[model samples]
Target: MAMTQAVQPVIRPATQPTTPARHVTVRGRASFWLFGAAACVALLVLLPLAFTLRQALGFGAANAAELVFRPIVGELALNTLMIVAAATVTSAIVGAAAAWFVERTHLPGRKIWAVLAAAPLAVPPFITSYAWVSFSESLQDFNGALLVVTTAYYPLIYLPVAAALRGMDPALEETARSLGLGPWTRFFRVVLPQLKPALLGGMLLVALGTLSEFGAFALLRFRTFTTEIYAEYRLSFDGSGASMLASILMLLCLVCLALEFRVRGLSRYDRMDRGARRAPARYHLGWGKWPVLASFAGLTLVTLGMPLGMIVYWLLQHGDAAITPVEVSLPLVLDATLSSVGLGLAGAALTTVLALPLGLLLARHPGRIATLLERIVYLAQGLPGIVIALAIVSLAIQALRPLYQSAALLVVAYAILFLPLALVSVRAALLQVEPRLEDAARSLGLNRWQTLWRVVLPLAGPGLGCAAALVFISVMTELTATLLLAPIGTQTLAMQVWADTAALAFAAAAPYAAILVGFSLISTWLLMSLFGKTAVLGATS
Candidate 1:
């Protein structure tokens, strides 16, 4: 009866769906810009590779083949492969064992042992070579190269593997135990498979480091592709030969990368259940505790104790000297230290900035394009510093004349060389940030830029810090690129150490080396303590 009065139902205006469309538009623009930025970064890193290829191609097929297939090339390749293989295997064993002891067992002083285990990374491989060479000339061969690199880089494996161990759910191990699996059997069957991604990534880095190593192999008199490439560049000043060699080196690195990627496959290792994870129970060492303690003690002594002891010993020896060629003056040491710190900060900041776009694209918009860009950036890791430096020198001389012989150019080289380091850490950090948080922020009417600036940046800050710190440590110890690209009179600590060491002025080099090592130690401690279980070396999947 009331409807007869024509009481029409009050209709609310249709809610506008413009918000989602606007969000989509903003996100689409952001992704487009991110792809552009990442593509630029990847192309910048590809310069060295492209240059090397061009130089190699300039040689006709016959000449290229001859250069590549010669006995010297074969010998260098053999030496490179042998050392990379041996060092990778040795590092894997030591790293996996050390991580297991520190993480899975109730070994006394486990925390101290963990720090000690990772501390060797603080000492650069070249510095380790110097220390070992100073300790005994017997170390100036393949065995010495093996020991030095293994010690310096095992921590690359150890850090990531330890992080994996810490994060792994214990339910699988418990199930294995219940099924009558022995410790060794369980580890071989279950734990090892879970460790594949981390282990493969670590091994890839180890192989690449060994492959591209120049300073360490040079100091040790080991003639790998890197050292030989350096010699080619130095002697001829014509990059044709060097580029050919670098092409071979790059080929080897690509092989390692491809194998690692293929072997890593698509297997996901995360836990299936959505339950709060408890810490894995530590195995009691019991009567084995004494032996485990002794082993860790020995490992620590070799990896950390020896390097520091040698550094200090050299410092004391230098202090007692009367007429050193390069006088180890307090002012000189301080100046070099300041230069190193300043350059390190610059390089770290610049590299992290350049790495951000690639990292972001890979993290949020992964696809064939993003994946290819990431691979291209990672290819820079395979480039020897000398190669990258020379490429930059050529690029600068030809086109960027203003940047030639400039610190800005050197910093750019650092960015190109270490983009992978920063990208890995940055991507890892971003992956930990839940995308839902960004979505929630958007739902609250925040613009895309606002969501990123307010929510994503804050969440990713620590990882970015870690990335910068990692790059800082690397740039501090970098030798080849610094040697080529440093503005004249810049005088970094690494340069000072290289100069003195090459001149056989070990005493003069000691002060610089000690200061460098000290900075590294402090940084390493911070990374381990502040970023607990964070894999600074990187991870796969």
Candidate 2:
């Protein structure tokens, strides 16, 4: 998950003075301690990357050159870049259009359409690929990969752009219209420029997702570096080459982070006036309304309805019968559900806990150490699940053999991968808990630890809950790491779905998919309802 600059704390008015000197000293000491702890956690996050680097570098220069100079490497890079480029552009266009129609236009059923458009997010990309491929034999290619990723990830762009659109000051658009600019001209000249930050934030997310994606690309037969890496590991047993490819992917991730930063710049979009901002005027789309409605309906059908419908269809379908009462084998479904929930909860808690020190440090300190630690987490987030899994697998085999393939190690991998999601939420929540509140607690004779326990934690509860919910949903739907590192003989709901789908047993996979989607939707609902009010939806995986 990437951090959005939009979520930074608002600058107080000139009347509010800066921190006093003594207070600054106390904060500095606290920050140093927090920084130390955060650095340790960040190293854990980077352990996999470090391992990858070692593996890549330890292979002699000739081997490295051979790995790096191959035609396939160039092909994979082109494929990945193409997918990222296409998906980012397409998702932005689609997500922005959907947001504009639902948020800025007088579209009928806007609320319903908005929810349904975003509902595809609950359907994991791999699941969407499975559904699409199952529905048609021809979807096992680049076109299918592009389509699957665009629908699956467009919501990443949609939610942020929608939020930005909702909060926008409408005075510019009104002025542009008054100057005789057409709607399209006004949108391009005035509105789109203003939405650059949100758009870039969403674009960066889509890019990162595309870079790290393994399942959808793999299932669709689109050969990206992530899939190739998996193939290298599983089929060729070429750890060195896989690590090198991962290193290149990680470098690409860094380049993306830098590019987004440069494009977003340091512009502040805050309204200067103290007056109450009026709601944006809705455009009355008379003749065009039905067409827009139909487009959104089709979008929802492909993205959300089709996958879900197919899951249910296979769940009920039997030979020569239109519908059948599918008897879900209780033992299998129950055990899988339980395992999924347990891992999800454990991963959520572990990730959130690991995230806190770093989150607090960044919120309170805002220095090089804090920035570096946070970026390390972001880098880890950008790496593929397979890379992280391999890194953890390597680490466990070398340092903790007994924990190899154990649930404990799996949870550790989850924490490593999803810790940024928690950090972003926790840091945003911590920002809301003002320093003065903690100061008041101290004035009331509470110790720092007690103040954090009584004051900050309670105030940040919603953020923590949202973080947990996000992580739980992510863990429940995660397929890559679960496929590799899950304990022997263990099957989570996702694992079962992947297994059955791999075997082309669509009917057998249907129940697991349904259950997984149900849990994911519930958790996603919790995330949006809890954190939407707080504007903490940054870089969700």
Candidate 1 residue runs with Cα over 4 Å from true position:
1-15, 274-276, 319-325, 363-366, 430-459, 529-541
By how many angstroms RMSD does model 2 differ from the true structure? 8.5
RMSD of each: 3.9, 8.5
TM-score of 1: 0.89
Question: 251-315, model 1: which lDDT tens digit per residue?
Answer: 88779888888999988887668488699989998899999899889988998888788888888
TM-score of each: 0.89, 0.90
The CA-based lDDT of model 2 is what?
Answer: 0.85
Candidate 2 residue 65 Cα shift, in angstroms, is: 2.4
| Model 2 clash tally, residue pairs | 0
Q: What is the lDDT of candidate 1?
A: 0.84
- The Cα local distance difference test for each model comes to 0.84, 0.85
